[model samples]
Target: MTFYVCIKRVGDILLSLTAIFILSPVLLVSALLLLCTGEHLVLYRQRRVGKNYRPFNIYKFVTMRSDSEKSGTITAKNDPRVLPVGRVLRKTKINELPQLFNILFGHMSVVGPRPLVRSEVDMYPEDLRQIVYADNQPGLTGMGSLFFRNEDDLLAATGKEPATAYREDIMPIKGALEAWYRDHKGFVVDCKIVVLTAWAVLHPGSAPVIESFRNAPGFPEKELTDYRTLLARTE
Candidate 1:
């Protein structure tokens, strides 16, 4: 295996195992809460396109009604389908923790382009497809994931149909960002992205001024400045 692939697999295994071990208690508590709130299902699995254009069931902690997608696939701000406990899980990203199992099972990576559904991947422009379809496993988090962390809010703010807004505005931007990550793939970049994700969650106002975001076509300008002023305090 190449150096990048070797380190990535090793890191994914070691880190995922360690995280699962350390967070066992948290996972247990979350599972119990999900059962109580969701009545039965604890894990939510959805088909996502992964490396080599293969499809796999991506797992997350159940946060919405089992049939919630009947209304729409895209979640909105204050989405009613979300259980009260699920809301907290989604906000804190505890819902995403189950993907550690994905990494361990070699279905995903610790960091890479976040996977999308078949409908979304089918919409990728040729230039974007070349990058995403290359030999890279989808990630638990990535550049697009971090940038679009508050995407539901943006959709709600615009009052646009969620799917239409995503197809016309959001998907294209996400494709470009994911393509950027593909071009810039490296160990250092992966580590930086993971750290930046945590930072973004804590400081939603401050988007990381990465090349991808700086060059993203049609990225919202006002959204960019949401937390730029906070830089003074950090510096």
Candidate 2:
């Protein structure tokens, strides 16, 4: 295993265990609520990219009706598949808890690239494919997740095809962040991203980097400031 991957395995396992211990009560309650509401599975899995250009199933709490991916991979915040409580979980960033196991398994990092679903993986550019696969391990959180944190809502607001926005706008930005991560990979930067991620989860309004991709150094951000303006004026 790679150095970070090995470290990730230990860290993720410990973190998963600790989180499970601390949150088991909430997990149980959440599970029962889902069951009572006929939500079925309390855990859900999907094919995601991981270290060395391989595919692995990623874990998440079941936040959507089963077969939620029967259509396409992009999730609009208003997606009918999202269960009521799922929305809260997703919004709170709690839905991603199960990924701790992925970290433990050494297939991911506490900070790295967000694992893309197989459906979305092809959207990555040819240049970035090798860059990501070199490390192969995905992350529980990463640069892409930080930048596109409001993506689902953006899609919902656009009323355009989610695929179009993803391919044209979101994926390009994601590619840029990944390239940055590839060039700047290190423990300290990972730490920064982790802290930034916590802030993002707690107060998404503080996402200054996401606000202006135009100034983000990598993305073609001319139109994004316009979106930011709309969000600010409306807010």
Candidate 3:
């Protein structure tokens, strides 16, 4: 392995294990809460395209009914399928904590492109598929993930069918952003992405700040700026 990959793998193992240990209590409580509140699984696992276009089960704390995606793949704002506890988990991104296990198992990296389902993968334009998916492991957080952190809200605002909006409007942007990260992948870049992701989670209203951090070549600057305006109005 190259020096970067060697160091990154080491860091991933250390950080992921530490996080799982520290967050075990939260994980347990969330699991208990899910069991007490409804008839749903505490953890949700679904197949997502990973590095080399390999398939792996991505895990997350359950945020919706077992068959919620049967109705639709995208979750819009005020999506009724999300349980009350789920809303808190989703908004706080606590729902993603279970992916720490995926990281430990080498199915993911702490910082890389966010994995997409097979359907989403199938829609990736040819160039993006070769650049972003063929050679990189999907991440817990990365450029595309942080840029579209408010994905459900974006979809809700479109007034188009959720899947339609995602395919036409959101997916292309995500593809570009992921492609950018693939080019810029490095220890320093991953650190910055992780820090920005934490900042976005804590300050969901800071669109301008988030947008500033995303200034990179090949990104659709105009679209991000427009989305920032939309986010500002919502705030």
Which candidate ranks first by lDDT, i.e. highest?
A: 3
Best by TM-score: 3
The lDDT for every candidate, in the order shown, is 0.78, 0.71, 0.82
Better of 1 and 3 by TM-score: 3
* lDDT (Cα, tens digit) per residue for candidate 3, span 1-235: 8999988989999999999999999999999998888665698999998999899999998888887988866788888898889999998899999999999999999998889887876566666766777679899998778878888877777778887878877777678778878877888788888888888887775555455656655566765666565555444
Stretch of 10 with least lDDT, candidate 2: 211-220
> Where does candidate 3 clash, by residue pair?
none
List TM-scores for all candidates, in order.
0.86, 0.83, 0.91
Question: Which pairs clash in model 1?
Answer: 205-227
Residue-level error in angstroms, candidate 3, position 178: 0.2
Off by over 4 Å in 2: 1-9, 157-159, 208-235
TM-score, prediction 3 = 0.91
Task: Give the better candidate number (2 or 3) by TM-score.
Answer: 3
